[model samples]
Structures are given as C-alpha cells and as structure tokens.
Target chain A: MSIEIQNLSYTYDPKAKFKKIALKDVSLSVEDGDFLAIVGHTGSGKSTLVTHLNGLTKVQSGKIIVDGIDLTGKFDAKKLRSKVGMVFQYPEYQLFAETVQLDVAFGPKNLGLDEEEINVRVKDAIEAVGLDFEQIKDKSPFELSGGQMRRVAIAGVIAMRPEILVLDEPTAGLDPKGKRDIMELVLSLKNTLKTVKTVIMISHNMDEVARYCNKVALLKDGELVGVYTPAQLFEDDTVEKCGLKLPTTVRLARVLKARGLIENDCLLTEEEIVAEIAKGGRHA
Target chain B: MREISLGQYYPTGSLIHKLDPRTKLLITIAYIVMIFFIDTFVGFGLVFIGLMATVLISKIPVTKILKSLKAIIFLLVFTVLMTLLFYGGDKSEVVLSWWIFTFYKQQLIDCGLIACRLFFMVLGPTMLTFTTTPVQLTDGMQSLLKPLALIKVPVHLLAIIMSITLRFIPSLSEETDKIINAQKSRCADFESGNIFKRAKAMIPILIPLLTSSIRRAEELACAMDSRCFKDAKNRTRMNKLKFGWFDPVCLILFCALFFVVLWLKFNFLPFVDLTSLGWIV
Candidate 1:
C-alpha cells in the first residue's frame, strides 16, 4: 500500500507564545517496498513529517492517507500504529524491560498476541537484527553494550511486525561499524521479512542514504524541496543548495568525470563509481 | 500540558524582576502573612488592588497571570461547593434548602472570603517565581537557611540539588513526551484502560524515563566532576545579589498595607462602618 500526504502543515504549541511553524505545505508519496530517505538540516521538519505517518501527531491542517486509512478522521489508532512503527533518535534510551526477551516481547504483547506468538516474534526479531537470541534473550537489556542495546530496542519495534518502519536517525551516534551493521540489518528486513514492505529513514549521512535509499525526499526550512531519485538528486547542486554536503561517492564521481575519466558523474553509490571506473570509459 | 504559568520565569527587565531574590522571597512571605491577617471585604479589596498593581508592574501579560488560576479552579469549585452545602454555624440565613443540604447566606460570604485568600496565597508566590530565575531562588533559599547550616545542615548541597532539579524540569518533560510518542507508535494504549491497566501501561513509559534520567544524571555528574566542581564554598557567582532602592520601598509599602488591612478588619475604618454593608451580621 502507498502512503499519501497532501498539503500537510503543522505548528507546535499553537495558540501560545512558543508556537512555531514546524512543517509547511509538504506533500509526498511513498510506494510499497520503497526505501525512502528523508534528508534535511536540523529543525527542518523532517521528524515532524515522519511522525505523521504513524498518526502520532494530530493532523492540524492536512490529509494523510496510509493504506486506505485516513488520519484526522475516526480511524483506529491501534491499526494505524501496527502498520507504521517508529524508532526514535537514540532509541537505546527506550530499553527498559528486565530482559532483552521481555523488552522485545513488549511490542508483540501490546499488539495482544498470545504467549506463543509473542515468543516466536521476539526470537525472530532478535535474530533478524543479527543477535543471538539464546545468548541475549534472558540477559538484561541494560547489561548489554551500547550497540547491543540499540539493536535490542530496534528488535522491540520489529517484533510488532509493522508494514512500514520509520527510523529517525537510527545510526546517529554509533561507531562506524555499528552504523554499517544497522544499515545492513535494515536492508535485510526489507528483503527477508514478509511483514515489513516499506522503509523510511531520516538521515544526515549522505553516503549511507546514497547507498541504501532508492528515492530521496529533501526538505528545507519546513518546506518540501522536491523528491528525486538518489542519482538524480546527487546529479544536481540541489543538495548543496539545500545546505547539505554532497555524498563522498558523488563528490569523487564529479572529479573523475571532469578529468575525462568516466561517462557518468552522478552515480549514487561508491561501488557503482568503482565499477564505472573499472570499465575504463573516457569522456569523448 | 502547556497551561502552566507558575514557576516559569518571564524575563521583562522590569523594576520588580531586577529586585534581589531574597527581597522578593521576603516580600512574598510578608504578603502571604498579611493575606491571612485580613478578613474584611475592604481588606480583600485592598489585596485585589495590590495584586493588580503587582501584575501590571511586572510587565507580564495579565492573561498569562490569570491562566495560572485554571490549574486550581477545580479545587476552588469543589471546596466552595462543600462549604456552601454543609456549613454549620450559630446564626445563618437560609438561602436555599434542597433535599438534605442547606445553603446558607453566611457560607456564601465565607466562601468568597476564603477563595480570595487561597487565590492570593498562590498568586503572590507565583509572581515571585515568575520574576526571579530558579538559580536566584535557590541562592536566596540557601542564604535564608544559612543559620540552620550552623547546626550541621547541608544548605549548600541542598541549594545545588534544588537548582539542578529545576534546570532539568523542561528537558525531562520533553523526554517524557518523546517516550510517550514512541510507545504510542508501538501500539501501546495509554488512554483507554482501567486503573490497573493504565498503571500497568505506565511501566513501559516510566521504566524508560527513569533509566534515561539515571543515565543523564550520571553524565551530568561526570561533566561536573571533570570541571573541578568540588563544593559551593569557593564558587563565586557572576551576578551578585544586591538589594536595590525599590526593595526598601516595597518593604515599607507592604508593612503599611498590612497595618491598614489590620485596622480595617479590627478597629473599623472611621469613614465607613463595615457592618452597614451587611457582610457581617
């Protein structure tokens, strides 16, 4: 199912002195099974937009339809939440259960699943995030390392088996290895899990987005800049103009093309650039 | 959640905001004491005038100050209703007799008087908090409790703890909101449930909130330790508190109002006999 947003606008703390216009007239669409990346500067309405997908924020003045469910109408919140699961920034801070198994079981239990189903989902989720279910299931979540704690938290959300998984800065403060590990796990979820059909990630790392995301949605100062293919977005100066740095791969490809080394300078990922260079094509 | 106006400082750079926090604290005490000492409509009228003047001079919007009344309005109504329905006294005219409950004209006046007392009791301290920053209040508290420190009280440590708690209120609230939304997205139903179910639901929110708070407190402690924060004995403040000219003027005016209210309630103002108004039978 595709999610549609139309003319969405939001102001925080409305009718007060601290009111701020967080999102302004943003319209976007996400098809099923699409790896969509939302990129923006800080305080640029990225988080506000994703929170709407799960109906966490009430639609002040707009329309958001997810899988035929219209938000702002008399709709089932539990149904909507089960469809869209959100992992907030610093998600490790959300781990609070006695054991990792209990923590992972929290979401499935909330969904009112039976004891047997909860156990199965918890084990599957922990395994899906590349953790040994037997080793960590009975252990306390707090006793784990930082990266392990974060993985356990994500496993909690995954245990619910949401159709659309939205992550806000999933790998924000992790080490380099932890960052790659999370991205790999997310990609695995798309390919392996039958329940998770679409993935939406808000990220600041341009290289990570270029490698994983199929479509890129750009936002600037509470406004939607535009939506484009990752290659198309990197091909132009739009990212830089929007106050974001270019991906390392895109930066390298530009120099190689300028020096008559490759035919395409807008390649999205590092491996694609390497492949293009290996083909030994020169600009005529 | 945003209806609060108390304990939130509004910086307006007015003369009242510039007064020493110690002076403000003392004045608030004097004002609360005077409120309890007065029991006449004339005295309450004088108080209303004083509160209005204070609100005006602070440069905070009158609407914002009045917004704080919303928090205690339910309590006010409940107490007044109880008193109005069940008042027992030596002499009281029956205003309304419904079923087993009797409403008295005497209780009506009493409720009005007590409500005003409660209202001013809250507003006076609220005004002090709205003008003075939390750190200043903490410092003033520590200074006031200095005499108790001679008896082995940890006043300085208590001051630091108070200031830190005040500093973390906004951040912790923001964190709580985040956790609530996160759990909501996980299909955690916080709104619809029996009391036990609701309390059970809070486990998901509270455990995470508590853990995160502990983590944050540890980080804060480490940061403070690295900065050589040993004790408050040698710590110097950049902005020292000084009693300005308006402080003495405010004190004298408050004392004068206290005497005038006392006279109005007891000796009876010569120009107008309060009994003629029929407030007292």
Candidate 2:
C-alpha cells in the first residue's frame, strides 16, 4: 500500500466544552499511482484523514503507515512532509514570496536542497504545472491573476518533488474555466511525473472527481463510509445517505435506466451512454 | 485556531446593546478613572454594585463575563503577589511574619483596593466589547476621532484597517488550521518537541501560512478593486448609527452613573490615602 490507515481516530479540543471527534476509526489504503478522490459533506473529516497522511493531524488511536513510515508521534514529521507535499484548497494562499520563482522555490529550499538543485526543481515544477518559466518568473505573484497565483502555489509544492501530491478542494472559488484547467493540469502531471505515484484529493465537485479519479473514498461524520472504484461506489445509494451527491453522469445514467432506456449498469461516460443508446435503438 | 472573541457581540435588544457605542466607550473610560481615584472598600462596593446592575440589565450570561476573566488570571495573580510583597502598614502594627516578609493590617487594605481597581479596569471595558460589534466600535471610534482628521490623522483609513482586520481574522484562522492539518497529514508534529525543535518545526507551517496570507491579501485587494472600492471616497453605510429612544435613555443612564461615580469619588467617599500610609516600603 502506498498509504495505509488502520483504525485511525482524532479529536479536537478533547477537554473543552465544545469537544469534537473529527475522525472516528477510519481505515483505508491507497495503492501506488492511485488517483483517489475523497468526498464528504462539510465537517465530515475527509480533510482530517488526508491531513494525517502528511502529519498535520496526529492520529490519536490509529496506525497510519505511509510508505512504511509509521506516522504515530514517532517519525520525523518534517521529512514526512517533504515526502508528501500538500496543496491547500485556496492554493494561492501559499504564495508568500515577492516573485513567482522565489515562491515556487520555497518547498525545495525547505527540503534543504542546494541552490543549483533548487533552481532546477523550481524550473521543473513551474513547467510541471504548465506555467511559463521565463515570462512570469520575475513578476510579483501578487500581480498575477487568481489562476496564475494558484499555479504558482501548486508549483511551490511540486518543487518539493513529493512521492504523493495531496490537494484539498484545489478548485474552490475558481471559475469553471479555471477549474477545468486545474483538473487537466493535475491529470497531465500524473501522466508525466512518474515519481508522483499517488494523487489524493478532496473535492465536492462529484462530476469532475468521477471523471478524473480512479478510486473514491466516501467519508461521513469522520468515518470512512466506503472505498471503492468510482463506478461501484457511485452506484451505491449510501453516497446520497451521507449527504453527498453522485456524479452527474451517474445521476443521468440512473435517470435513463429508470425510464427503461438503458439495460447495462456499466455505462458511466458520455461516449458509453451514446453507444448504449445506439445499441438500444438497434435492438428495438 | 478559533476566531478571536474580541469581536463576539451577542446581539440583543437589551439596554447595554441599545446604548450608543460611543456612550459606552466614554462611560468605560470614566468608570476606569473613578476606579483608580477612589481607594476604599466602600467605593469599590459602589462600583461593584453598579457593574452588577448593568450586567443584569444587559442580560448577558454571567458565565461569559467570568470566562473573560480567564484570560487575565495570570495578571491578577501576579498583582496580588506583588501587593503582598511590596506594601506595608504605616500606623498599624504588623500581624503576620515570614522570612523577610511582613503582613500588616493596612497593607491588606491597600492590596484589596488595588485588586478592586484592576478588576473594574478589566471588567468595565469587557462589557462594552462583548455587547458591541467591531463595526459599531469602529464607527463609534470614527465619530469620536472626527476632530483628529482635521490634523490629517487618517481616522477613516484607521477605521478601514480595523474593520478589515476584524473581518479577515476568522478567515485567516480557518486557513491556518487547514494548512496546519495539511502539513500534519505529511506527519508534521507541532506538539511534543523542545522549544527550539518546536520553533524549527513551525517553519513549514509558518512559511505556508505567510505565503497564503500574502496571496489572500492580494486577492482581497483585487476583489475590492473590482467592486470599485477607492481610497478616500465617501461611501453609503448599510447600517447607519442613529440616536433612537433606546439610545437616549441608555445615554442618560450612563451619564447618571458617571456623575454618581464622580461625586462618590470626589466628596462623600474618603480616599484610603495610601501614599501617606507608607505602603511602598
């Protein structure tokens, strides 16, 4: 397993008047190179679990073995962080330096990389995020638009060269075009960056996640409700029960099936639905 | 990181919330001055009684008021300790004794008076903050400081900064928590380290948090610009401060309390005369 969580649990303000159990014995595993999409309602602890992978939240009563390193109050958290770089929801918030190049190079510098090596990593990371290395390198990140700032932030994490790239709602507050571009960029990075073996992301946009992620983990009230292939997981009714919506394609397929227009349950894509409709026409 | 409670205003139609924030602010300042001026138990009793009456009329939970005291517990204890160690009675004979320490009758009285002064200083203003929102506080400050603007004090700019700081505090705290957790998932332990190690570990969090804050500031600037928010431009307020019947009544009550405090401090109440008591020795 690229990442393994066993009976993990976490609570916040455990002794306060408003104590909360943010995670409740959630256990799951993701294989190397798995594009796992985590979905949940607000305050459902999806963010809590993914954060544990990098040691943001300590696992109170569980075992989180990520790439064979036990992250249970014993390991070097900073080294672990370098290994699994996280891109926050509003990635632009991570842009601290004046210039784009310096901002992108922050992670590499934190990793204690040499100046020459850090320069290469910054250039490669900028390129990996499909940002022009020369055109905007010297410009202040503050002067860039929202999309460019986000790219710079992502490149900052990419410069760390983590084995796993975890993102939390990376497309939040972005326009549709911006969202589409970010999703495509992540997919392209996965295709090109062989060392980036695992991509764990939390998103509420069910349709985009369904199209992009190979695996899906559903969380409800701090519990891992289910983990399955997107097709299988989306087919189940529990997703709706957990206050989450299914992908639009899955919803459309269900509607079509309910109308007696389709026979097969495996249709999840637009082209697949078209083929199924054509088959229905031929049979009729 | 929970949002700071300084801007936590429990909205109610009670007398305290209805009072003009400017009136409350002035009254708080005057009450604090009176607290320091009168140095006797009888004066403190009067202030305490007045504060209790205000609390009852405001209808705010006593628990919340007491909880606000939690933040200043250390200061309170330190003040008590200092009073015990430093003060001594001049006319009265010493009572209790320890190694190089003497407790006298007048020293105890002096300590009690100081404690009361500190208590009123903290409690009087806390009631104001808890009852009034940051927006109202800024508006009240702006109105009160209007004279300063003639001297190019930039009262409007100061108010804008205050409001923005109040507005972004919660947002930034939420972001900090998220970034901390994101770093934690990578196994970043903020707890269970020596001071140096802990400080070193915070670099990852601090770097990401600072970066994000700068970015947010830029985004906020853009958003403001797109909405045509220009510096030094007169803008209409969605909620304007106007003196209604409730405000006038509360203002009169506050004025009455201030005058009563002023009278009690200056005439009828005798100050403890601590300076002549040789308490400093």
Candidate 3:
C-alpha cells in the first residue's frame, strides 16, 4: 500500500464554542502506482483530508500509515515531506524568487541537497514539465505568462523528487489548453517514473477525474461518503444527491444508452464512449 | 491568529450611529477636552455622569466598553503608579510609608484625578470607533487633513494606502493560515520548539508567506493599473463627508472646553489644584 488511513477523524477547535467536524472516521487505502482523485465542494474537508496524507495535519484520533510507516507518531516530518511532495493550489502565487531556476531550486535547497544534485533535479523537473530550460531558467517568474508560471511552480515541487506527488487544484485558473497540457504532463510522469508510486489529487472537475483517476474518494461535509472504483461511484444513484456531477463521458454514455444506440453499462472517457459508439455503428 | 480585531465599530442602530462621522469625531475630541476642564471632584463627577449617559444613549453594551478597558488595564495601572510616585505638592504629607516608598496625601489625590482623566480620555473617543466604521474615520481624517496638500503632501495617496492596508489585513491572515497548513502537512512542527528553534522553523513558513505577499502585491498593482489607477490624481470621493450644523455645534463645545482647560491652567481651582500642596515639586 502506498497510503493507508485507518479510522481517521479530525475536528477543528474541538472544545471551542464554534467547534467544527472537518473529518470523521474515514478509512481507506491506496495501492502502489494508483492514481487517486478526491472530489468535494468548498469546505467539504477534501483539503483537510489531503493535508493529512503528508502529515501536514495530524490525525487527532486515527491512524495514517504511509508507505508502511505510522505517520501519527512524532518523527522527522521534514524528511517524510521530502518523500511526499505537494504542489498547492494557485502555486504561482508562491513564486517569489527573482528567476525561475531559483524558484524551482527552492524545495531541493530546503532539503539541504548539495549543488550538483540540486542542479540535476532542477534540469530533469524543468524538462519533464515540457519547459525549455535555457529560455525560462533565468527569467524572473513574474515575467512569464500565467500558464507558464503555473507550470514552473509545479516544476518547483517536482524538483523535490517525491515518490508520491500530491496536487491541489493544479489547473485551477488555467485555460482549457493549459489544463490539457498540465494533465498530460502529470500522466506522463506517472507512467514513466517507476519510483513515483502514488499520485493523489483534489479536483472539482468530474470530467478530468473520470478520465485519469483509477480510485475516487467522495467526501461530503467532512465525512467520507464512499470510496470506490470510479465506475462504481459514478453509477451509484446516491452520487447526485450529494450535489456532484456525473462525469461528462458517463453522462454522454447514459444519454447514448437511453437512445438505444449503445448496449454496454457505461464509459468514463471520450475515447471509450466513442469506441462504444463505433461498435454500435457496425450493429446498426 | 486571533488578536487582530480591526476596530470597535460596533454595528448598531443608535443616536451615536446617526451622528455624522465628522460630528462624532468632533464631539469625541470635545468630550476629551471637557473632561480635562472639570476642576473639582464635583465637576469630574459630572463629566463621568455625562459620559455614562452618552454610553447609554449609544446603546452599546457596557461589557463591550469593559472589554476595551480590559485591553488597556496595564497602561492604566502604569499611569496611576507613575502619578503616585512622581507627583508632589506643597501641603503634601505622607499618607502611607513602606520601606523606601512614601504615599504623599497630595500625590494620592493627583493620582486619582490623573487616572480618571486618562480613563475618560480613552473612553470618550472610543465611542467614535465603536460607532463609526474605519472607512468613515479615514474619510473624516482625509477631509480634515485635505488642507495639508498645500504643503505638497499626498493626502489622497495616504488615504488609499490606509484603506488598502486595512482591506488586506484579513486576506493576508487567511493566506498565512493556509501556508502554515501547507508547511505543517510536510511535518514542519511550529508549536513545540525553543525560541531559536521556533524562529528557525518559521523560515519555511515565512519564505512562502513573503513570496506570496510580494506576488499578490504585484498582481494587485497590475489590477489597479488596468483599472486606471494612473488617473488616481484627480479622483473624486465616492462618498464625500459633509459637515452639518451638528458638526459646528460640536466643534464650538470642544473649543469652549479647550479654553476652559486653558483658563484652569492659569487660574487654578483650589479643590483640584495640587500646586498649593506642592505636588508639582
């Protein structure tokens, strides 16, 4: 298992007049190399749950055993963080260094990595994000376009070389093309990097999750509604009751199936939906 | 994360809220002056009664005022102590003695008067904040200080800066909270280190915070520029503050009080005058 959360519960200001239950009795496990997508509305506790993965938030009354180690115990958290890199929402907002290279070097430098290793990692990270090294390496982060700066921010986290990469709304404000490019880069990294064992992301875009995520965790008002394979969760009638959208491809598949043009249960991606339609065309 | 309550500005419908901010500001100033003009304990007593009446009319909870008082308790204690130790009088005689410390009778009286005066000074004007929004206060201040532009000072710029900084306080606080959460996720323990270790631990938090602040500032500057901040030169007020008859009436009362205090300064009243007791020495 890449990550295992057992009987997890957390509350904010538990004894205060305005105590809030941010998380409750959520138990789940992620397999190695699994791509997990968590979906929830604002304040639904998705942020709180993801923060717990890297030990950002302590499990007040539950266990978060990551990579076979009990993270609930007090340990060298900084070292643990290096193994679980987090690229935050609006990451461009954190770019403060004078140049892109320096900003990307920040996390690695914080790890106390020597100059040679840091340089090698920065080069690989920049290249992996499809950014031209020489052109952008020395430019001030403020000087880049929004999408470019966002990618550079991602590269900064990537340079830290974590086995499990966690992204919080990585494409939040990007244009459609920018979003596609970022998603593609993420998929490529997951496919090629053997040591990159788990990828967890929080997103509201159902279509994006349906296309890429193998496992989905649905959170509602800080409680784990269900954890299931994407197909099982989407096909369940209760999903819409929680104010969630059916994935775009799944919706289309349902529409096609209703019109008697498709016979299979459902599809979760544009390609699968189209392939199913092509199969129907031969039958017609 | 919690100590920053912008200002009192208690949201309520009351006679104080109905008063023009300019009027409230003027009256608060006048009230402080009037408080100082009270010569004897009777006059001081009258001032206290008047302030209490105003507080009642404002309809603000007395507990709220007491909360403000609680914040300034240390300052109040220090002021009273200094008055007792330093103030002297001609007829001053030791009321109590403990080792090297002497409590002179005249000094005791001075201490009581000064402490009450300081309390009234804080309490009187605090009503302005408790009644008026910070925006109104800044607007009042800008209008009052408009003539200072004759000295080439950028009054408008100062107002914009004040308003923007006030607006960003809550925003920056929330941002700092998020960044702290982000760092903590990585096992950065902030709460359990020595002074030096804690300060060192803050580096990870501060770097991201400072970086984000600068980035946001730049974005804000860009947004302001696009919104024609360049034409910021001759911008008219969205809500101009107009002085009414109430404002002049309040100003006159304060001017009268100021003159009375000045008069008392030269022609001191015997009961309130500690000079005869040689308290000034």
lDDT of 3 by residue, A212-256 (tens): 899999988988888878888888655677788888888887888
Best by DockQ: 1
- Number of the candidate with higher lDDT, 1 or 2: 1
Worst 10 residues of 1 chain B by lDDT: B1-10
Poorly placed runs, candidate 3 (over 4 Å): A6-21, A58-63, A67-75, A113-120, A132-136, A236-238, B1-5, B8-23, B32-167, B183-281
RMSD of each: 4.3, 6.5, 5.6
TM-score per model over all chains: 0.86, 0.70, 0.74
lDDT of 1 by residue, B77-152 (tens): 8888877767776345888788987767777778888888888888999899889987888888777898988898
Q: Please write out the lDDT profile of model 3 over residues B107-215, one tens digit for every residue.
A: 7777778778778878887878898988888878777778998998998898888888888888888888777765554345678768998897787667768877776
Give the best candidate by lDDT: 1
Q: lDDT of model 2 at residue B160?
A: 85
Candidates, ranked, TM-score: 1, 3, 2
Please provide, for model 1 over A127-218, each residue's C-alpha lDDT reduced to its tens digit, 9 standing for 90 to 100: 99999999889999989999999999999999999999999999999988889999999999999999999999999999899999999999
- Indicate the fraction of true inter-chain contacts that candidate 1 also forms: 0.78
Clashing pairs in 1: none
**TM-score-superior candidate, 2 or 3:** 3
Model 2 chain A weakest 10-residue run by lDDT: A89-98
